[model samples]
Target: MTSSLFYHVSGDGQPLVWLHGWGVNGSIFLPTVTQLSQYRSYCVDLPGFGDSQPQPGTIDDWAELLIAQLPANAIWLGWSLGGLVATRIAQRWPQKIRGLITIASSPCFMAQTTPPWPGIAATVLQQFTQQLEQDLQRTVERFMALQAMGSNSARDDIRHIKELVLSKPLPNATALAQGLEMLQQTDLRQELPHIALPWLRFWGKLDGLVPRRVSTLLPQTPQSQDIILPGASHAPFISHPEDFLHHLRDWLQTTNKGV
Candidate 1:
């Protein structure tokens, strides 16, 4: 990992790393940091977003880069695309992960027929990829709008997401393209069953990008748990931070007792 991949560490308790979703930076987790202040938290600007410089590679490569920087044996909380990266790290470096939490994330972000996993249509993703090439700013804006589509407080959610994105430097265009490609091509369904760490998956009932139907297909291990927020959308942490944090704290206290 390069020194340019910026991260901020705060609080003073069990270590927790917060990974933001696509098109945004570590600042996306500002609400999370405030609510989950009991734990030592590392909020990272994934390579290419915010102050971090871009590094081109596959999902696995991105995971490796992050793994190099992250503290050992820390709880990882990833949102959207960051979830996929977190899963990759857990799969490859199991000993480094204490627990795994995925918010509004899916194993397979693009739809599949044989397994019937709910996801975005490939063509729609392609359209976003194409649009991104022409107008990076507008494409990101459209994506932010889509994230807030199904929330009960859609207007507020949209405004909140927009404000966060604008708060940081605009994400690198190359990084945006790479993230869309990862969403389209990366599939971890087969690997899900092998992850041995305690796993908690959070879903938004009204999420448009990652359909709630995918939750039904998650691995059923003793260590695995799934929660779907009613009337919440893709960005539940932004839209329903209280409910999100409530469940998160409960899970941390119960599932990861010693952490």
Candidate 2:
């Protein structure tokens, strides 16, 4: 087993595993986690991304491996690519998850015949992928910049994201390529109906990565709720901590009778 898959645990209550986005480790959720003192928080660094070692299989294999590393049942909070991981968890093993909260994520990142909000063009993704192949370090920097784009706190947020990425030494090239490939091919629209747990979907209204309208793709259930963070970009957990915590706490209360 790779050490990169290791998790950092803190706080106390029902378990809450934090799954970070691509190009980053678990520290990306620090702001939100600070506010979630009531839950036992376990922040997982994706295989090959932080202390974890690279997995030798498909994305599903990696996801399964990661899932196995967690507690039997817990609330999953995933961001960006981590959200995709969370989606697969709730879809394939709903009984193992108490609830799900996805922030700045979309069911499908790649554009579809029916697009979810406007996402980066295929050509743009390809270009970035190519850049990643040439220089993984610069690629991460570029990705972090894109994540912070249009935010008033762009400078600090990007810096924090950079620090998060650097906290764990840069992931190897193969892992970076695989991550981007997963982003390109993953489509979660049809699988949305399989999720049975309460889902809270959070979005930054100004997110350039995941379109705000993509929230509609998920299966509608009485337990599912969608919220938009105004003037926030893709990283609402950092850019709008207060609002993020407000909605998250409210959702926790409404669903589990208070956290």
Model 1 spans > 4 angstroms off:
1-3
Among these predicted structures, which one has the highest TM-score? 1
Residue pairs with backbone atoms closer than 3 Å in model 1 (clashes): none
lDDT of 1 by residue, 149-225 (tens): 97999998888888877888999998998998899999988888899999999999999999988888787888888
Q: Each model's TM-score, in the order given?
A: 0.97, 0.94
- How far residue 120's Cα lies from its native spot in candidate 1, in Å, is 0.4
Clashing pairs in 2: 3-51, 3-52, 4-51, 4-52, 4-53, 5-52
Among all windows of ten consecutive residues in candidate 1, which has the lowest summed lDDT?
A: 1-10
RMSD of each: 1.2, 1.9
Residue-level lDDT tens digits of model 2 in 68-184: 889967889989988988888888888887899998887778876553345557887898788986888888888888998987788898998887668778876777778888788
